[model samples]
Target: GKVIEGTLSVHAKGFGFVLVKKGTDIFIPLEHMLNAMDGDYVSVEIVKKVPKKNPEGRIVKILTLQNKEIIGVFKSSKEGGSVIPSDERYNNPIIIPKDSLSSPKIGRKPKNGEFVVIMRTGWNENDHTVTGKIIDILGKPESKEMDLLLVARNNDLTIPFPTQVNKALTGLPEFDLQKELKSREDFRSVPCFTIDPESAKDFDDAISLVQLDNGRFELGVHIADVSHYVREGSAIDKEAYERGTSVYFVNNVIPMLPERLSNDLCSLKPNTDRLAFSVIMEIDSRGIVQKYRIRETVIRSAVRFTYEEVEAIIKGKKHSHAKTIHLMQMLSLILRRSREEMGSIDFDISEAAISLDEQGVPYSIRPRERIESNRLVEEFMLVANRIVASHIAKKSTKRNPKPFVYRVHEKPDKESIQSFLDLLERLGLKYQLDKEVKSDDYRKILDIIENLDYKYFIEKVALRSMTKAYYSTKNEGHFGLAFDAYTHFTSPIRRYPDLVVHRLLKYYASKEKDKKGAMKGEAATLSKKLDSICTHCSEREIRATQAEREFIKIKSMEFLSSKVGETYGGIISGMASFGMFVELSHYVIEGLVHVSELKDDHYDFDKEEFTLTGRKTGKVYRMGDSVTIKIKSVSKEEKRADFLLV
Candidate 1:
């Protein structure tokens, strides 16, 4: 009935869809796209309406261009040069003028088959091409440098801090130890320590534990005070908001802030005094929070312990903080039990750790182990987040809650849950679904299958049935954590939402004298802005996750490239009419076994049972069935591997 505004998501085939904030996507055919490229904000008028299928639309106007630069492979010919975009959404190649290549600004001409970053100058609709100039050369394809650059450019991740941002950082006040101690709660004498990976350089969180005289424990979760350094609306703050979150690739990181801030000023380095937004909770021996306080504080970390070291300490190995470590272990277990009793679902999925050589090529791939030390830190962070969120939620009524960002995990849809139950029934597993199935029901099913051979497959299916968590201005509660209120309040150095939480908390705290008056005007402004911020942060988080997964996949394929013809045992992780995916044992890599590779007999796919059965021979290949397979081939560019049944 009227022109609607939304972000245009262009497909590789020239067609696209306009994703509205509160409605279903409007499908725009190729001809009706009105020259709108991928990631363009556009207004569209509905041309056709359908009940079940997507509504058709025609682009009315281009509001803005979201993607201004592209990373692609440069192909030069005698006729001219063009760049084939690495991002599939931008199907058309960008035409580059020969003279522009040799320009003084460009420095040198890009060679054929080289990867390059191109800044869009203009678009030629009639010619169906985009015009751009070579901004940077990103080495050869499949190389580590090129792969990382491609991921960064495709995700719109800014690699370098702007001059203005750097200048703003330089103008920031140096850490005045005396002034900070006077202004903030002095926790410098506390026995605080950081636990992180051995390779980590930026430590954003620290923990401290003390036995209280009242027979309770004082558990402190201190987060790096990033918001203190990054002033709101400043160049640095604006840049950080746009980035939304730091992206961690397998071998590199694209930080939201400058290295000066993230790695030095805001890092909780051992033996150094640092500012922190701390959550101090007085929790009983039973893991119940009796009281808590959120405060700006100064802390000096007594030591830095890696997860490996903590694990050893927990295993009774002698260490300097052995007593504190034992107490932490005890508290974490109590808290974990408390959560489990409340129906928190723990999806204990292992991730792949790809070891790279000096050249950035993967030398090995192994499943990363999750130990008790990891859980000890995680449980504390979760509790700290919950404590802060509950404080905010309680301070403001449900009808008029404060403007805050929450990490929300919604309940699974009924249809997905039913499908999961059906699958379980077919697999001969016992699971009685109630009218309203809580997370505890799922946990029960998981516990039953914990020792089964098909446990991983079942867990994957259950996970797929669940919805993804995202940042939202509305507190819908975190179903996964079994918390009625929760928000990310830690790791400001890496996560932007955590930084935003710190800023909002500080803003609210500053208006304690006129809380009601401040909530009426300033809170309204914040509420309006939070919607967009939450949406942007959620989208960026998804993009970062995708990029990380793609990086891992690329490296996994590379690791298998040299192992062609090698045999390994694998479980059938997935099945389709065309092929089946097999996940190798002891490795996190999955390879496809095409249906055509089953040469012995004609196969029939049973979708209901998720199996491929041989018609004459009566042999079947089912999900979770272990089989021997030989690596057939590897495609590094496609991030794929082929396997043949042995």
Candidate 2:
């Protein structure tokens, strides 16, 4: 028997899978598990290996528990109390004795049916019972606030700012704004403005444009100087690093930094002199950068325009900066075309914009419209990220090198790419890839399928084929944006990596001016520090993204609860061994249509084509297939919906 160790992911049903480093996951039946829960790291011994089937393994050891603390709804009984896990994937309840509640951390006994968190304690394997101590009592699950709180707790997101961080903020010393202004470059004279979402408060970036005498355009991208206020290794910085990135849950946001810094001091509020790291570039009409300057500067934005307002301006509306915005639009188009020509893969994906009322009830959920204004801001940020990455890369030659964090997107694997191409060819669209798949090849395939009814399906498949972009000390380049170098340098208010990038730039700037000595060996130390930070921050980023998506899914489930049994037009968005996922046409929501619901005929799953063929009726259900489905059930607790094909 061979033993392998990996994290265990338990299904809602009792069985689980051990996700190893490579290949198919090892299947662990319920009886074989040693009461190991979901997210637990465990060692398994391979018992059987059959061809064309996943290797079967029995859990030999429970190395460590993934979730030390669990979130659940408390139930008080005469004997004691038991907390039912909120995720439901855990499928186990923790019992808490009445004595454990005498001096609970929350200072009171949790009411029956109240949401709470508990620390794991000893357990009995014979009775399949586990014990825990109540630590915190979250609100009742029926409460309006519980919608978001439940999602946050389930995702392991700690929302409240630590008291130590707040105390450190109060003890922060003040600096003279005027004195600091004299020491940095001044960009206050530029006619700059911030364009963000209508509800945005933390304006971290601003845009300014000027026409140069050499028949070139001067584009200025200014970002908030968050690192200037939150000193490194301070309590505030430590807390921000722990949070890593902000979690935007509909209207509620869990900011990485406290509001005092993210919303006030570090925010680039309009009509105020704020410290900034600005990148000014001189470019020709075709969007080729002739020259660029990166500096620390003081800027005063004249106004803050929302994307909607700018969209109106683009459509011939009148504003003081209407002409400037129009100019920005022209420049964005050129830059977009230039980048695409250089093989940038622009997956024209639309993001869902869920609108909720004051009570956290969703009134509408639809894809956000792509407009010229959105493209304008995107082009500027992409250019700035690329230019900053290029600047840092050049400073590090072979002999005299510097350590920096780069956002790298590696080339897609050939197997995944072949699957994507096969799907396109099956749909009657023919496209070819070079010896090595070029970014533009995917872009060209997208263009061919642009007007197809199943374009979204094809686009998603292609996107999945590509590797996820991440931070690294080594430069693998950005395949999506077609950039030789790229980094996140635009939003320091919400992202920790951006703040670190700002610090690195400032350090280089100071070193260049002072020509200083005795900062030797700092590069080596900083390199190690940055490499570890990149891995931690990347993990935190994925957590934040999952929490955000889960919140939306939870809310969507709530919205569909009353519509049970109602029929809606849907598209088959995904396929799995158990069921097919259906995307409801009316709303930005998807639900599962389990195979058991297909009672009309015995169905055979076509693994290669990702389709379910009805043996008697000759009906095939597949990705992008349109069908009418009735909502069967909605489990708000589990954040899942069940659909039946009508």
Candidate 3:
């Protein structure tokens, strides 16, 4: 028995590789890798394979298996029932024996078009199949919220908190009701307000800005003090740790905390006495931070403004609260200066938002925007995060200062960056990015993209070349934010990290004796756990994103199901030897344009550029290139949609 330790990297074909120590990845064949799925840790034996081409292995020893379960589409066969798993990486299906059926006869099932969650019972090595029992029947995947539910289940996301966790939230300390807010700073008199989307419930941040006598401006970044409600080691805290942040899907949101906290108690609702962790900064006309203060305060937001109202103010049109239009102008200037001095990359990407009618059918997809209010709140939050991170970093020494979690974004892979640079060159853009390219250097690339004739193409390429940011114990600095020290401290109502930051800050803010040391030790423990939490949260976030995308895809397919033979403008999203994926421009719906459907001529895949090139006519369909496509076939059962190049 050989012990191999590594992360499980899944392949598109359902099989996966246990990426062992260093770059050594051992292939876990579909048959032998039992009780092991994607993201699982397992020990494997070198079952006869040469090292040169690829190392293959068999699972002869089982050290530990991840308790993570998967949600997928279930199927039944003539020879009994089994699940044809939906995850592309998990190639093999779990076969449910005739006797394993819960109630209905093994062969008799839901009209051949339902979805189910399969519980992995065991695996049969000889037959090379996974054994499972049908645990649930997630009726028609085409339903309104079924796609979201399936995606969540598939991504290992628990849509509802466990019974125990929910019950534990009852009878919480009446800290909010107790009028012990005498000592805290009262900002209720000030005209502080919240600005968020119309549908937003978790209002984490509020803003209050006023000009001082000396011409300097006082700005407040007030965040919901969720730490005041969820104590350390509490069930809610543990659950929040498990779910690092709330996952917002197309139609619903899987909240990090319960609705009582996220939407009611901890939310910065207008005209309500809400506890908040605030960052008050005094700045001159030039956006220079003159003085800053971090304090736990009580706030009652005067009003709530939507992004539309703020946009109206920015456009110089008279809207509600026209008196504070000057503040909006000042914030605009501050954002401009921050972008200029910080070299923030200007990346404008469109997001698809679904609108459904009474029948639950998607009526439209409107592009979402980040209006002036969004930017104003963003700048203030960034300032607060930067200040808090800097304070923590400065207070902590090189050897052992204070332990704190910092959001870090490492440099993108050199190869991937070079590839993107090469694409930019091919697109006839002039921008130099080499080994010395820092965070600020991204601005040059952004500038080139902005100036390019094909701005969208260049922007897409640039985006593909960037690395994602995540929270961590070690500080590598955030490359995207152009910050030396950055932490998320302005969304305690929604993000667990923000709650942690609030707890640490309030602990240090306490004037009472003997409380400071215990807070420091607790903060250290949190700091140490940051890395593990970072990885878990990052993985969960990705899973949630993928699930959302899949749900959208399903909805798109459902929409196209009734429109077969209808043509629409589309962009090539993906390509393979068999077919190319085209996303409709109007609805952002994706479907496969099969190779055989190219009636004009036979096409061959250009591997170098990832395009399908017609051999005879020289027509090419490449990623991001626009073309017209007609829906050919759609099957909600198979979860597939096909299109033909028109």
On residues 246-325, what C-alpha lDDT tens digit does candidate 2 reach at each position? 99988989999998888888788889989998999998998999899998889999999899999999999999888888
lDDT of 3 by residue, 1-646 (tens): 4556776667765576888877578887777766467766666777666758557877654444455555566666775677766666665677777666554533435446577766677755565356777767777766677767777777677888988678877766546534647657777787788888878888888888888899888888888888878988888888988887787766578989998888888888888888888889888777878899887788899888887777777778786567675585676577568656786665776666787676568767756666666777777778888888887787676454566678888877888777877766665655676657676777777765675445665666677788878777677787877878898888876677777777767655562334443345655676667667667766766766777777776666666688888889877877899989877777766688888888788899976677788888998777778889888899764568888877
Q: Candidate 3 at residue 344, lDDT?
A: 65
Give per-residue CA lDDT, model 1, range 413-483, as digits (tens).
99989889888887898687778878888888999999989888899999999999999988899887889
User: Ranking by TM-score, best first?
Assistant: 2, 1, 3
* lDDT values, one for every candidate: 0.87, 0.87, 0.74
Regions more than 4 Å wrong, model 3 = 1-10, 14-52, 55-83, 88-99, 103-112, 120-131, 140-143, 173-179, 316-320, 451-453, 511-526, 573-579, 599-604, 611-622, 635-640
Question: Which model, 2 or 3, shows the larger TM-score?
Answer: 2
- TM-score per model over all chains: 0.88, 0.93, 0.85
Cα displacement (angstroms), candidate 3, residue 323, comes to 1.9
Candidate 2 has a TM-score of: 0.93
Number of the top-ranking candidate, with TM-score as the measure: 2
Candidate 3's TM-score reads 0.85
- Model 1 scores what on Cα lDDT? 0.87
